[model samples]
Target: MTRLYSQPPRIDAGLFFLRFTGCLLLLHVHGLPKIFHFSEELTHIEDPFGLGPWVSLLSAIVAEVICPLFILVGAFTRLACLPIIAVLLVAMLFVHPDWSIAEGQFGWLLLIIFTTLAIAGPGRWRVGASQSREVRYGAG
Candidate 1:
Protein backbone atom coordinates (compact mmCIF):
# COMPACT_ATOMS: atom_id res chain seq x y z
CA MET A 1 0.00 0.00 0.00
CA THR A 2 1.17 3.55 -0.75
CA ARG A 3 1.84 5.85 2.16
CA LEU A 4 -0.10 9.11 2.43
CA TYR A 5 1.87 10.90 5.04
CA SER A 6 4.28 13.80 5.02
CA GLN A 7 7.60 12.10 4.87
CA PRO A 8 10.82 14.05 5.30
CA PRO A 9 11.59 13.86 1.60
CA ARG A 10 8.07 14.89 0.73
CA ILE A 11 8.24 17.84 3.08
CA ASP A 12 11.59 18.82 1.67
CA ALA A 13 10.24 18.58 -1.85
CA GLY A 14 7.31 20.78 -0.90
CA LEU A 15 9.62 23.36 0.59
CA PHE A 16 11.80 23.36 -2.50
CA PHE A 17 8.74 23.82 -4.68
CA LEU A 18 7.60 26.77 -2.60
CA ARG A 19 11.03 28.41 -2.64
CA PHE A 20 11.64 27.78 -6.32
CA THR A 21 8.24 28.99 -7.43
CA GLY A 22 8.07 32.01 -5.15
CA CYS A 23 11.61 33.17 -5.88
CA LEU A 24 11.23 32.47 -9.58
CA LEU A 25 8.01 34.43 -9.80
CA LEU A 26 9.46 37.28 -7.80
CA LEU A 27 12.69 37.42 -9.81
CA HIS A 28 11.13 37.04 -13.25
CA VAL A 29 8.28 39.48 -12.67
CA HIS A 30 9.91 42.12 -10.50
CA GLY A 31 13.66 41.71 -10.04
CA LEU A 32 15.02 41.17 -13.56
CA PRO A 33 13.08 44.12 -14.95
CA LYS A 34 14.72 46.41 -12.43
CA ILE A 35 18.15 45.47 -13.75
CA PHE A 36 17.33 45.21 -17.43
CA HIS A 37 15.59 48.60 -17.45
CA PHE A 38 17.29 50.48 -14.66
CA SER A 39 16.80 53.89 -16.23
CA GLU A 40 13.13 53.38 -16.80
CA GLU A 41 12.60 51.87 -13.35
CA LEU A 42 14.30 54.82 -11.71
CA THR A 43 11.92 57.34 -13.20
CA HIS A 44 8.79 56.02 -11.47
CA ILE A 45 10.28 54.24 -8.48
CA GLU A 46 8.29 54.86 -5.32
CA ASP A 47 9.93 56.88 -2.56
CA PRO A 48 7.40 56.25 0.17
CA PHE A 49 9.85 56.91 3.00
CA GLY A 50 11.42 59.90 1.17
CA LEU A 51 14.63 57.92 0.94
CA GLY A 52 15.18 59.31 -2.58
CA PRO A 53 14.56 57.48 -5.78
CA TRP A 54 18.05 56.05 -6.08
CA VAL A 55 17.98 54.64 -2.56
CA SER A 56 14.47 53.32 -3.02
CA LEU A 57 15.30 51.58 -6.26
CA LEU A 58 18.52 50.14 -4.87
CA SER A 59 16.71 48.87 -1.79
CA ALA A 60 14.05 47.24 -3.92
CA ILE A 61 16.70 45.67 -6.10
CA VAL A 62 18.46 44.20 -3.10
CA ALA A 63 15.25 42.84 -1.57
CA GLU A 64 13.67 41.78 -4.82
CA VAL A 65 16.76 40.77 -6.79
CA ILE A 66 19.68 39.90 -4.54
CA CYS A 67 17.81 38.48 -1.57
CA PRO A 68 15.62 36.34 -3.74
CA LEU A 69 18.74 34.97 -5.40
CA PHE A 70 20.08 34.02 -1.99
CA ILE A 71 16.79 32.40 -0.98
CA LEU A 72 16.63 30.56 -4.27
CA VAL A 73 19.91 28.85 -3.45
CA GLY A 74 18.85 28.28 0.19
CA ALA A 75 21.75 30.41 1.39
CA PHE A 76 20.67 32.27 4.50
CA THR A 77 17.11 31.49 3.45
CA ARG A 78 15.46 32.76 6.62
CA LEU A 79 17.61 35.87 6.76
CA ALA A 80 16.98 36.57 3.09
CA CYS A 81 13.22 36.43 3.55
CA LEU A 82 13.30 39.28 6.05
CA PRO A 83 14.17 41.95 3.48
CA ILE A 84 11.60 40.63 1.02
CA ILE A 85 8.94 40.57 3.72
CA ALA A 86 9.85 44.09 4.70
CA VAL A 87 9.73 45.37 1.15
CA LEU A 88 6.42 43.66 0.47
CA LEU A 89 4.97 45.06 3.68
CA VAL A 90 6.08 48.57 2.75
CA ALA A 91 4.71 48.25 -0.73
CA MET A 92 1.40 46.75 0.30
CA LEU A 93 0.74 48.49 3.57
CA PHE A 94 2.41 51.88 3.10
CA VAL A 95 3.15 52.70 -0.52
CA HIS A 96 -0.16 51.49 -1.91
CA PRO A 97 -2.44 51.33 1.09
CA ASP A 98 -5.26 52.43 -1.16
CA TRP A 99 -5.01 49.26 -3.22
CA SER A 100 -7.86 46.89 -2.58
CA ILE A 101 -7.34 43.19 -1.97
CA ALA A 102 -8.03 42.48 -5.60
CA GLU A 103 -5.36 44.91 -6.71
CA GLY A 104 -2.74 43.90 -4.11
CA GLN A 105 -3.31 40.16 -4.31
CA PHE A 106 0.08 39.48 -5.85
CA GLY A 107 2.01 41.31 -3.16
CA TRP A 108 -0.08 39.72 -0.44
CA LEU A 109 0.43 36.26 -1.86
CA LEU A 110 4.16 36.78 -2.06
CA LEU A 111 4.07 37.87 1.54
CA ILE A 112 2.35 34.66 2.57
CA ILE A 113 4.80 32.53 0.61
CA PHE A 114 7.90 34.18 1.94
CA THR A 115 6.55 34.26 5.47
CA THR A 116 5.91 30.55 5.32
CA LEU A 117 9.40 29.92 4.00
CA ALA A 118 10.86 32.12 6.68
CA ILE A 119 9.23 30.04 9.38
CA ALA A 120 9.76 26.71 7.71
CA GLY A 121 13.32 27.24 6.55
CA PRO A 122 14.57 25.98 3.17
CA GLY A 123 14.14 22.30 4.16
CA ARG A 124 16.34 19.48 2.88
CA TRP A 125 17.40 19.30 -0.77
CA ARG A 126 19.03 22.69 -0.45
CA VAL A 127 22.66 23.70 -0.65
CA GLY A 128 24.26 22.79 2.66
CA ALA A 129 21.08 20.97 3.56
CA SER A 130 22.65 19.48 6.64
CA GLN A 131 23.64 22.89 7.88
CA SER A 132 20.08 24.04 7.45
CA ARG A 133 19.04 21.40 9.97
CA GLU A 134 21.68 22.62 12.38
CA VAL A 135 20.44 26.16 12.07
CA ARG A 136 16.81 25.19 12.46
CA TYR A 137 17.16 22.56 15.20
CA GLY A 138 20.37 23.97 16.71
CA ALA A 139 23.94 22.77 16.41
CA GLY A 140 24.90 19.80 18.52
Candidate 2:
Protein backbone atom coordinates (compact mmCIF):
# COMPACT_ATOMS: atom_id res chain seq x y z
CA MET A 1 0.00 0.00 0.00
CA THR A 2 1.26 3.46 -0.91
CA ARG A 3 0.28 6.58 0.97
CA LEU A 4 -0.33 9.79 -0.92
CA TYR A 5 0.12 13.20 0.64
CA SER A 6 -1.75 16.34 -0.40
CA GLN A 7 -0.94 19.85 0.62
CA PRO A 8 -3.50 21.95 2.44
CA PRO A 9 -5.41 24.43 0.34
CA ARG A 10 -4.20 28.00 0.26
CA ILE A 11 -6.62 30.29 2.07
CA ASP A 12 -5.43 33.51 0.41
CA ALA A 13 -7.48 32.94 -2.73
CA GLY A 14 -10.57 32.16 -0.70
CA LEU A 15 -10.04 35.22 1.43
CA PHE A 16 -9.56 37.43 -1.60
CA PHE A 17 -12.69 36.12 -3.29
CA LEU A 18 -14.75 36.37 -0.14
CA ARG A 19 -13.69 39.94 0.55
CA PHE A 20 -14.16 40.97 -3.07
CA THR A 21 -17.57 39.39 -3.39
CA GLY A 22 -18.74 40.62 -0.01
CA CYS A 23 -17.72 44.19 -0.73
CA LEU A 24 -19.44 44.13 -4.12
CA LEU A 25 -22.61 42.72 -2.60
CA LEU A 26 -22.62 45.30 0.13
CA LEU A 27 -22.16 48.10 -2.39
CA HIS A 28 -25.13 46.92 -4.44
CA VAL A 29 -27.45 46.08 -1.56
CA HIS A 30 -26.71 49.00 0.75
CA GLY A 31 -24.55 51.63 -0.93
CA LEU A 32 -26.24 51.91 -4.31
CA PRO A 33 -29.71 52.37 -2.86
CA LYS A 34 -28.58 55.15 -0.56
CA ILE A 35 -26.61 56.88 -3.29
CA PHE A 36 -29.30 56.57 -5.92
CA HIS A 37 -32.10 57.64 -3.59
CA PHE A 38 -30.26 60.55 -1.93
CA SER A 39 -33.46 61.48 -0.12
CA GLU A 40 -33.72 64.36 2.29
CA GLU A 41 -35.38 62.01 4.73
CA LEU A 42 -32.33 59.83 4.97
CA THR A 43 -29.84 62.64 4.71
CA HIS A 44 -31.68 65.32 6.68
CA ILE A 45 -32.09 63.12 9.70
CA GLU A 46 -29.31 63.75 12.17
CA ASP A 47 -26.62 61.10 12.15
CA PRO A 48 -26.45 58.76 15.08
CA PHE A 49 -23.43 60.63 16.39
CA GLY A 50 -25.13 63.97 15.88
CA LEU A 51 -22.80 64.73 12.99
CA GLY A 52 -25.76 66.05 10.98
CA PRO A 53 -27.30 64.46 7.91
CA TRP A 54 -25.11 65.94 5.23
CA VAL A 55 -21.92 64.69 6.81
CA SER A 56 -23.43 61.29 7.43
CA LEU A 57 -24.69 60.93 3.88
CA LEU A 58 -21.40 62.05 2.41
CA SER A 59 -19.46 59.66 4.58
CA ALA A 60 -21.84 56.86 3.71
CA ILE A 61 -21.39 57.50 0.00
CA VAL A 62 -17.63 57.52 0.28
CA ALA A 63 -17.55 54.35 2.34
CA GLU A 64 -20.28 52.35 0.62
CA VAL A 65 -19.80 53.29 -3.01
CA ILE A 66 -16.28 54.59 -3.59
CA CYS A 67 -14.40 52.56 -1.06
CA PRO A 68 -16.32 49.36 -1.71
CA LEU A 69 -15.60 49.61 -5.42
CA PHE A 70 -11.91 49.91 -4.73
CA ILE A 71 -12.12 46.95 -2.40
CA LEU A 72 -13.96 44.86 -4.97
CA VAL A 73 -11.28 45.50 -7.55
CA GLY A 74 -8.55 44.87 -4.98
CA ALA A 75 -7.13 48.32 -5.55
CA PHE A 76 -5.65 49.64 -2.33
CA THR A 77 -7.77 47.11 -0.50
CA ARG A 78 -6.20 47.81 2.86
CA LEU A 79 -6.37 51.54 2.50
CA ALA A 80 -9.95 51.40 1.23
CA CYS A 81 -11.02 49.55 4.36
CA LEU A 82 -10.30 52.59 6.51
CA PRO A 83 -13.44 54.51 5.56
CA ILE A 84 -15.55 51.37 5.71
CA ILE A 85 -14.23 50.52 9.13
CA ALA A 86 -15.02 54.03 10.26
CA VAL A 87 -18.55 53.76 8.96
CA LEU A 88 -19.03 50.42 10.67
CA LEU A 89 -17.73 51.72 13.94
CA VAL A 90 -20.10 54.65 13.74
CA ALA A 91 -22.99 52.30 13.05
CA MET A 92 -22.07 49.93 15.85
CA LEU A 93 -21.63 52.69 18.39
CA PHE A 94 -24.49 54.98 17.44
CA VAL A 95 -26.89 53.44 14.96
CA HIS A 96 -27.51 49.86 16.04
CA PRO A 97 -25.92 49.50 19.40
CA ASP A 98 -29.02 48.25 21.18
CA TRP A 99 -30.47 46.22 18.34
CA SER A 100 -30.86 42.53 19.02
CA ILE A 101 -28.47 40.18 17.20
CA ALA A 102 -31.34 38.69 15.25
CA GLU A 103 -32.58 42.07 14.20
CA GLY A 104 -29.28 43.30 12.77
CA GLN A 105 -25.88 41.64 12.90
CA PHE A 106 -24.73 41.66 9.32
CA GLY A 107 -23.24 45.13 9.60
CA TRP A 108 -21.20 44.12 12.59
CA LEU A 109 -20.04 40.98 10.85
CA LEU A 110 -19.05 42.97 7.77
CA LEU A 111 -17.08 45.34 9.95
CA ILE A 112 -15.11 42.45 11.35
CA ILE A 113 -14.51 40.99 7.91
CA PHE A 114 -13.40 44.32 6.50
CA THR A 115 -11.08 44.82 9.43
CA THR A 116 -9.55 41.43 8.76
CA LEU A 117 -9.05 42.29 5.10
CA ALA A 118 -7.35 45.51 6.10
CA ILE A 119 -4.84 43.50 8.06
CA ALA A 120 -4.39 40.67 5.52
CA GLY A 121 -4.75 42.81 2.39
CA PRO A 122 -6.12 41.60 -0.94
CA GLY A 123 -3.62 38.74 -1.17
CA ARG A 124 -1.39 38.06 -4.14
CA TRP A 125 -4.11 38.09 -6.77
CA ARG A 126 -5.16 41.70 -6.87
CA VAL A 127 -4.93 44.85 -8.97
CA GLY A 128 -2.51 46.07 -6.39
CA ALA A 129 -0.19 43.23 -7.39
CA SER A 130 0.28 44.58 -10.89
CA GLN A 131 0.65 48.10 -9.64
CA SER A 132 3.23 46.95 -7.17
CA ARG A 133 5.12 45.15 -9.87
CA GLU A 134 5.07 48.19 -12.08
CA VAL A 135 6.35 50.33 -9.28
CA ARG A 136 9.12 47.91 -8.51
CA TYR A 137 10.20 47.37 -12.11
CA GLY A 138 9.49 50.86 -13.36
CA ALA A 139 6.88 51.65 -16.05
CA GLY A 140 6.85 49.47 -19.14
List the RMSD of every prediction in angstroms. Answer: 5.4, 7.7
Cα lDDT tens digits for candidate 1, 21-130: 99999999999999999999999999999989999999999999999989988899999999999999999989999999999999999999999999999887787666
Q: Candidate 2 residues 7-75, lDDT tens each?
A: 223665777777777797778877888877888447454487677788888888899899988887788
Cα-based lDDT at residue 44, candidate 1: 98
Model 2 CA deviation exceeding 4 Å by range:
1-9, 40-46, 128-140
Most TM-score-accurate candidate: 1
- How accurate locally is residue 39 in candidate 2, as Cα lDDT from 0 to 100? 89
Candidate 1 — what's its lDDT?
0.91
Instruction: Give me the runs in candidate 1 sitting further than 4 Å from their true place.
Output: 1-7, 131-140
